[model samples]
Target: MRATAEQLRALRQEVAGLERWQAETTPRRMPLGHAEADAALGGGLEVGRLHEVFAGHGADAASATGFAAMLAARLGGSLVWLRQEQVGREGGALHAPGLSEIGFDPARLVLGLLPDPLTVLAAAGEAARCPGVGVVLVELWRMPRPLDLTATRRLALAAETSGVSVLLLRVEAQAQASAAQTRWQVHSLASVPLEANAPGHPALSVELTRQRSGPPGGPWQMEWDRDRGIFRAWDGGGAALSGPQLPLAAHG
Candidate 1:
């Protein structure tokens, strides 16, 4: 027999309670599919935390942005990217077509061009609290003094409370103190050469500069495989160089 309204309500409550319990008990780290990188990242980058990526020079800004995009793609959800107007103008606006060529899905992206740091932070905080956003990326060419510990702490709390990942992209910024769970320094590396000496997958020389939970360690040479949507160790002289590189001139 079909259940009465009261019985159906009770069953719904039970299901909701079970889901909440599972979320609380399950491990939050989502693996990047690279064994070594995942191991160094404490089983993978943890969700609900603020992570920082620093670019040492103006040239490395592209590498940093690419790395952050790959991470957001790995998280497998819609992304919200916030950038101050000045940074956007200086670093070049994030081009959708260019980003898609690098493996980021343009359809899942939302861009916010704010006028100032405070506005950017405010937008990021609100976006982080939104359950629909999978990842929130905030770009800061220089971390303003106003974005002190309290501000970062607020960002961290928002991410944690909503179970979203936050990436802070700092271009040409000094490594100062912050409340980020982990900090990375990224630099562009020569991409693997494909058949006919073509440029292959994008590569980055990533160094783990800081970690709040464990000892930070890495100078890992990593590559992003757009086909597989995961990171892999840069194979120096092996199958990585044997195949033809994927073309970016066109896409489905």
Candidate 2:
């Protein structure tokens, strides 16, 4: 059926209006601004959901922790970090100066130490219920038997209801069933230096092993910008100074 010009114009206007409404009403996503990665993630990482970051091996634990920290920093409002005592003892505490180097302000960070996994989860659940907090990060050295499906579900529900992003960081842990909206496996890779013989921002070898809304993605090479505190898609080289940089808002 052939439509008149006026009919076609009306249809286009309607579609545009619908899109605008969706953008305003639906929860916003935080994009890395790398075209390919953003497209794979259906625009960006979904807010108000549970995300799991797992270290592929013991050596990758630091990389995973840094990755999770960057995510929390990106979210921007009051941040809470709950760490299991054993994990803190083994991995050491998050350094204030180091966090600043990665673009995270140490002043906005709140730290909590818990003796056991159950207590850590309880704290995370409570933090996730706070609408004022932009993100809550929980570090568990290993997932114990007590952290079963029900426990994860409770965390997920709290995040969704409160519209707070929750990051579950499992260090030196293996893959297992989870109720998280997305799961990422991280490993450290060689970073590209800015000048001859000088160190550069760290690189991460990341793979999306599971996602509730999209096909598993990546094994993408991504690099961090210490100054900007954001990740960019990398192909093993130094970032060009003259280019359109990814937009980093005060709040993601």
Candidate 3:
């Protein structure tokens, strides 16, 4: 049966109203590690969705880990770091101080170097469904073929419903297209002086390679101070502290 013009118009209005309601109710903003990145990200990383950071092969894992830890820490919740390969042997364990400086409780953070990517994804989906977890970071070299868009969309929806943030950290060269909301490429920037004239530690330079909802190709830089176990922004003026200024939570 063909619908009349008035009926079609009414349906369109109803759909528009529903979209507006969803937009108003959805939690759409998160604090990115860097202010510039946040601006480029259209706010910050959107909560309740999957964001991908693709640090290409030969990319510095320390910097990538530090960046992820810093962001996760600010979000203030339990974090699960899933590694695709063995951590102790293949690469060094993720730097604990890097996360600590960002204010993540060591006890709340769970690190797992899984043998299978599917297992990690499954765990992330479950975590997203649960309210206990605040964020889940999955570090994988690649995604198995069978776990495609359907699987990812399921996770995304779960995150939305449960208010969890899922971050997928892929090795620089290996991160191919996926159903992620935002994708980034991170590189290590040269260290600067901690104080005026005093030498400072190195930091990470991140670029927003792709984003579903915002502009791409941002040269956002953030520094990880090993001694302090914290992350700060790197402005050309100096290594001044920038980004979200939330209080650091005490670690257990």
Compare the candidates by lDDT and give the number of the best one. 1
Candidate 2 backbone collisions, by pair: none
Q: Report the lDDT tens digits of candidate 3 across residue range 28-97.
A: 6876546667777776778877877766445576667666776677666789877766544566677676
lDDT of 1 by residue, 96-121 (tens): 99879878889999999998888999
Residue pairs of candidate 1 with colliding backbone atoms: none
- For model 2, how does the per-residue alpha-carbon lDDT over 78-134 read when each residue is reduced to its tens digit? 789998777756788778898888888889889888988889899999999999988
Error of 3 at 237 (Å): 8.0
Q: Candidates sorted by TM-score, descending order? A: 1, 2, 3
TM-score for all predictions? 0.82, 0.82, 0.74
> Which window of 10 residues has the lowest lDDT sum in candidate 2?
237-246
Instruction: Please list the residue runs of candidate 2 whose C-alpha ends up more than 4 Å from where it truly belongs after superposition.
Output: 1-25, 237-252
lDDT of 3: 0.69
RMSD of each: 11.4, 14.3, 10.6
